[model samples]
Target: MIPWVQLDSAKTPDGGQELRLKQRGAEFSIMLGTNELMNSRLSGSEEALAKLSCERIVGRSQPKILIGGLGMGFTLRAALAELGADAGITVAELVPAVVAWARGPMAALFDGCLDDPRVSVREADVGHIIRSDKAAWDAVLFDVDNGPEGIVYKGNDALYSAAGLGAARAALKPGGVLAVWSQGPDSGFARRLKQAGFVVDEVKTRANGKRGARHVIWIATLA
Candidate 1:
């Protein structure tokens, strides 16, 4: 059995805790304390959400997208592949170390997508950015935390709240979509999106390439 090796660590904005990145051979994991929040090669749910969301939002004119996390850049790269040359992307990553990992060790996984002319990386909280902006994005795809039912951090609870959904609705352009990735189904959150005045669609996809654990992606449209 291979032992986990520490790759890097960063202090969260609150400064009360730290986010750590670890590697066991080719596998990578993100941790806060004993909680294994996410893993690069293991979390297929996030990747599926990114791909499906981009497919729905991408158009002939090219589009602008905001991705909430840069984990392994699977979503980012998948989006760039789907969107092609004309589209532009803004990636907001809360943890600086994750960004560093994207450029440093995990660069190949992203294929230098971060340096792509069409992509811009913002080092900030996604929730803050969503609240401050207005009608600027075509699609806001969030894979941050662990969906509405958070496991990595408690502060993430707000992202799935009614107020958060309201702010997200405000940030989107007309007909823009808010695509969220969740490990499991949350019927209550779907209702909240509807309560926030969005036309919502719940998509279920397999986490394994073949077919296995089901993951959910909530696509809410500001129609």
Candidate 2:
């Protein structure tokens, strides 16, 4: 039995909470208080976030997208695997330490995906990126918090609000996708996506491959 070791910690942008990076043998986890934000071993739903989104814009040439969180790089690696060489992905990770964890202790888990030519990592708020652009991305994926309710960073809740959803809608190209990962279901979130003028599909996925905790991913298509 291996014990978990705390490698490093970082504060949320609002400074109300702290994120801890822990490692147990070969496995890694990012924790917010007692809640585990992400685990290297449980990436099924996160991978699905990118896979489902990239799957939607199959034929679009030189597709470009924005990913809200860089978690354990599951979404980024999944997107890189699904997208062609021409595709582009910008990942906005709010906490610099998380990015450092990706390139540092969890580098093996990331597997050099950060160095991929099509990928770019930014230490900024994804919402700002969403607001600054208009019809710029073919897909916009979010895995920032536990759900639309927010856990790691409370300010991220705005990214799921009516106005925030509208900004996301405006950031996408016509028929583009907005894929969001959540720990559980949120009926109000689905409604907000619909109210934002998106054709939505609520998908239930597992934390692991075919087992583990059930997670949700909202595949909202801007049409």
Candidate 3:
């Protein structure tokens, strides 16, 4: 077996905690110590989130999509596979290093998604983007944090809060969808979605293939 090599590293804004990127043969992974934050090739959470989020409103021509994170580009790729050419997608990635990792050592995992004409990558906070716009997107898919409850960053709390859901609602077109990915079920988040004037649907999917880590995808529709 080949050895894992450190490809790159960066310090986050808030805590100055280090984010490390590593490559083992053809596979790439992000880590914060022994914990594997993300693996591009495996892409369990990303694939599930994309599929559940895009399942319902896929065929709308010129549909606009807002993806909250750019982990491994799996979500973007899966979304592209499901959406049409006329559709456009904007991916808001908070950490520039993650974007660099995608374009650098882990580039191949993305399979040319960065250059896709319909796709744009933004280096900024997704919460800010969601709060800024009004009725701008046909679909907003959020895979940031580990659900309504976050792990890496505390600021992520707002993305799952009532005000954040409200912002997400304001950013969507009437009948537009806001899909959020979670590591586990959050009945409280579901309730918040309902209270925020959205018709919510909770869908659970496996992290790998049709079976693996149990993941939740919350599909919320603007009412």
Best by lDDT: 2
User: Residue-wise lDDT of candidate 3 within 1-223, one digit each (tens)?
Assistant: 8999998887754664777889888888888667676775566667767777777676676889999888788889989888878989999998899998889877788889989999999998988988888889999998776678756667888898999888999999877999998888988999999999999888877777776778888888876
Say which candidate scores most in TM-score. Answer: 2
lDDT of 3 at 130: 81
lDDT of each: 0.81, 0.93, 0.83
* Native-to-model Cα distance after best TM-score fit, residue 49 in candidate 3, in Å: 1.9
Model 3 pairs in collision: none
Tell me the number of clashing residue pairs for each predicted model.
Answer: 0, 0, 0
lDDT of 2 at 144: 88
Model 3 poorest ten-residue lDDT run: 10-19
**What does the lDDT come to for candidate 3?**
0.83
Question: How do the residues 1-223 of candidate 2 rate in per-residue lDDT, one tens digit apiece?
Answer: 9999999999999999898999999999888899888898999999988899988999899999899999999999999999999999999999999899889999999899999999999999999999999999999999888999777888998999999999999999989999999999999999999999999999999999999999999999976
- Candidate 2 all-Cα RMSD: 0.7
Ranking by lDDT: 2, 3, 1
